[model samples]
Target: MTRVQANLLLLVIALIWGSAFVAQAQGMGVIGPMMFTGIRFLVGALVVAPLAWREWQQLNAQQRAPGRREAGKITALGVLMLMGAAMQQIGIVHTSVTNAGFLTALYVPLVPVLGIFFHRHWPHWSVWPGGLACLVGAFLLSGASSLQIGVGDAWVIASALPWAVHVLMVGRVADKMAAPFCVASGQFFVTGLMALLWALAFEPATLQAVQAAAWPILYTGVMSVGVAFTAQVVAQRYAHAADAAIILSSETVFAALFGYWMMGERLSPSGLAGCSLIFISMTLIQLIPVLKRRYS
Candidate 1:
């Protein structure tokens, strides 16, 4: 796909992801964190399983069955994604949407840095300056006046590292595999299985929480994960990688707006300033290639 199309897809994905914060917050009201994640992934698995199964069938017919190495890699990716999802959900319960959105967005900048360890694909020199600015901006946006990290904030930050890992892995596998189908199927299966185990061991499996969370869970499971993620896969096919990052980064903007509209959450001036700086940094990173092409 063309760069423009990929970028547009990422923007759509960002919008859905941003709005999902509300669903997440609301879901927490009725269920425990692990239970909420379990149910959400169960719903997502049910929704995506059919399509993924079909894709898997095609893959099996086209290629050899995955050997131990391939199986291990897929398993690793699923585990990482599951952990990231759980941490983000847990973090959202304790922090503001603005904070969750910006913190999660850190994966965008972190991706390139992580890549450095593997391919030695260091980011442009400008990226370090921009990244530090983004970090400070995230601090402000999250309303951290001091270095003391709240439980939720810490969870979110910790989640960011795994998410960065997820992003890097996805990029690596994307070229060699049918990324959308593989990722959707793998994550669904892994997270669903994990949730079931947790439910059996810890959760009461009561219908009460699920019943109360029905709407939010359905919205998150179906629209956010199902449709929105599909859009991201399709859009990235046409858009530039940098453009995709910028578009996805807009999740912060949408989350802030949604918080005000739905939850009546207000961002302080400092928070807004921090968010703006992060946005600027994200935009700069996206533009680096264009700048290089023009000036270098």
Candidate 2:
């Protein structure tokens, strides 16, 4: 894919992801966080299972034996992704959409931090300043005062760590598999199974709750998880890591806009300023390599 196409795909992913906040919030009104996630992922898995099966078939055809190592890597990557998605969903139930969106965006910067453990590569000097700015932005967007973190804010921040892990795992394993099929299948199956376990253990699986949240569940499961996730895997294949980070960061902007327009949740001036700063920080971090290459 060309850069333009990749960017556009990222934009689509952002839109779906951003709007998903609304779905999550609405779904929570009728069911517990884990229950909602369990059902949503079950639906997502059903949607993507065919894709994964096809990919598995293709792999079998291409190789005499697709080894256990490769299979294990795919399963590990899928599990990481499932954990991240579950955390994000549960966190969003407790946090404001603005907080959820911006805090999740932290994974964009956290990706480089995670690289240190595996590759022993420190981020460029510019990254520190940019990441700090983004951190401050997260503080403001979270609407925390007196340095006291709310339950929702804490949950979202915790979610960020696993999300960072998800991004790193995808970076490592995504290239080895068929991008669309691998992502669609892994996300669908892993998340689906986890959701089912949660539902069986804690949730009663009520038809009433499911009926009440039908639209949101369908939107999140099919559009957000199935379609948007597939696009993300495909687009990230073509884009640089920094560029992908920047693209994903746009989710915060779309989330804030959607909240204001759809839910009548207007942001204060400080909140808007914080959002702007976060965007600037992401843009700078993404561009730092280009700047260094030109000047050095």
Candidate 3:
């Protein structure tokens, strides 16, 4: 596919993820966050397993079966996913999806900062300014102005840390693997199993509860995880890193829009300004380095 097509695919993935925020919030009405996450990821794994199996077969035919190390990385990625997803789910129950969406985008600037500790690498110059903007924007967006941030907003902010790690790990590990689908499936299964363990132990998930949350489970599982993630893996191959990052960030805007329409969530004028700053700074942080690299 051409770069344009690849970028378009990324945009679609953003839309799916943006709207999935609504489903996620709604899912918790009758079930625990852990239970909702557990069933959702399990469904995602089932939906994507066939594609992973096909790739596994292809790898076997080529005599290049991915090693146990890759498997381990996939498992690690799953753990990160579980952490991020669980916190976000829990936070959404207490906060608006709009807040959750915008706050979650905090992970974008964070990915590079995480590189400092984990990868022993510094980020681009833009990250410093962008990071500062994000800090202020988050303060406004999540209503920390009154010196009393909501519990849910704090939880969502906390989730950004693992998500930052997950993004870095996916680039470090998943991109190196031959089969993106296999990596996606493996991680989904790991997250599902882990969350299921927690849910069975602590959360009471009955047939009634499951039935009540069934639509959300399927929407997030099938659309968000299965299709959007797979499409992202595929699209990134043909997309410019700058364009991909910028386009993927649109999910936050989509999330806010969906939250307003479906959940009737509204951000104050300060919050809207906060969103704009976050978006602009993030785009520049991602785009500037790519442009410098191209023009040198």
Candidate 4:
């Protein structure tokens, strides 16, 4: 795909993810987080199965056989995905959809920060300033002026760490593997299995609850996880990672818009400030280097 096409795909993926936050929040009203996550990912796995199989068929024997290294990466990705998804799902029960969307976008900033430990590298100078902006935005968004954060908001913020880790891990795996669709499918299956296990252990999941959540679950699984994730993998191949991240971060804006339009949700003044700061920080992270290069 051309760069323009790839970026547009990322934009579409962002819209899917953003709008799905509303579905996720609504789904939580009918089922526990674990059950919702389990069913959604299970549906996603099924949706992507055919594409994964096609990708597998094109690979040679050696590549088809999962290596220890690749297996480890896939497992790690699945674990991170589960953690992030579960946290976000649970968080949705307590927070506004707008809060969930903005808080989740904190992952865009956290990605480079987490690299310090995992990749043994420091972030750019721009990241520090941007990180500060995100922190302030988060503080305002959480309504911390009252010296308290809602439980769901806290959980969403906590989930950003794992989300960042997942993003970096996906990039690494994408570079090494020829078959993005297969990797995406495998991770979805693994996440689904683990989430189902969690649900069975702690949540009172039932057929009735699943039926109640069916539409939201199906929409999230089919459009958000299956199609959006596959599109991300394909688009990233043609677009620079920084540019892709910037476009994808627009998901937060889309989420807020969807939340407002569909549910009549509105953010408080502090919340709007938080969203604005977070967005400005995201833009700075991507724009700084370009400006530096151009002026230098």
Q: Pick the winner on lDDT between candidates 1 and 3.
A: 3
Per-residue lDDT tens digits of candidate 2, residues 1-296? Answer: 87567767887888888889888889888877766776776787677778777777787788732456756776776677667766777776776765675577677778777777866767677767776676677657656553435787677777777767765566446665654666565656666677668777977667887899989989998988778877777776666554555557667667777989899988777778778887787677656776788899
Query: TM-score of each candidate?
Result: 0.82, 0.83, 0.82, 0.81
Misplaced by over 4 Å in model 4 are: 1-9, 61-65, 87-106, 120-123, 142-158, 235-250
Instruction: For candidate 1, write residues 30-136 as lDDT tens digits.
Output: 77767777677667767877876787788789884445676677677668877887788789889876567567767766766777876677656666766677667
lDDT of each: 0.70, 0.71, 0.78, 0.78
TM-score of 2: 0.83
Residues forming the 10-long window of minimal summed lDDT in candidate 2: 140-149
Question: Which residues of candidate 1, in runs, are more than 4 Å off?
Answer: 64-68, 87-109, 149-156, 230-249, 294-296
Task: Estimate, for each residue in 30-122, the C-alpha lDDT of model 3 and write its tens digit.
Answer: 998888888888898999999899999999999977888888888988999999988887888788765775678677667666677787876
| Candidate of highest TM-score | 2
Q: List the residue pairs that clash in candidate 2.
A: none
Candidate 4 lDDT over 1-296, as tens digits, reads 77667767887898999899889888988898888888888899899899888877777555564567876787788899999988987897898765775677677666666666777766568766766676667656655443336999899899988888777667557656877887788888889999999999999877988999999999999999889987787777776554555567667667767888999988788878877876787667667876898999
Q: Which is better, 2 or 3, measured by TM-score?
A: 2
lDDT of 2 at 107: 78
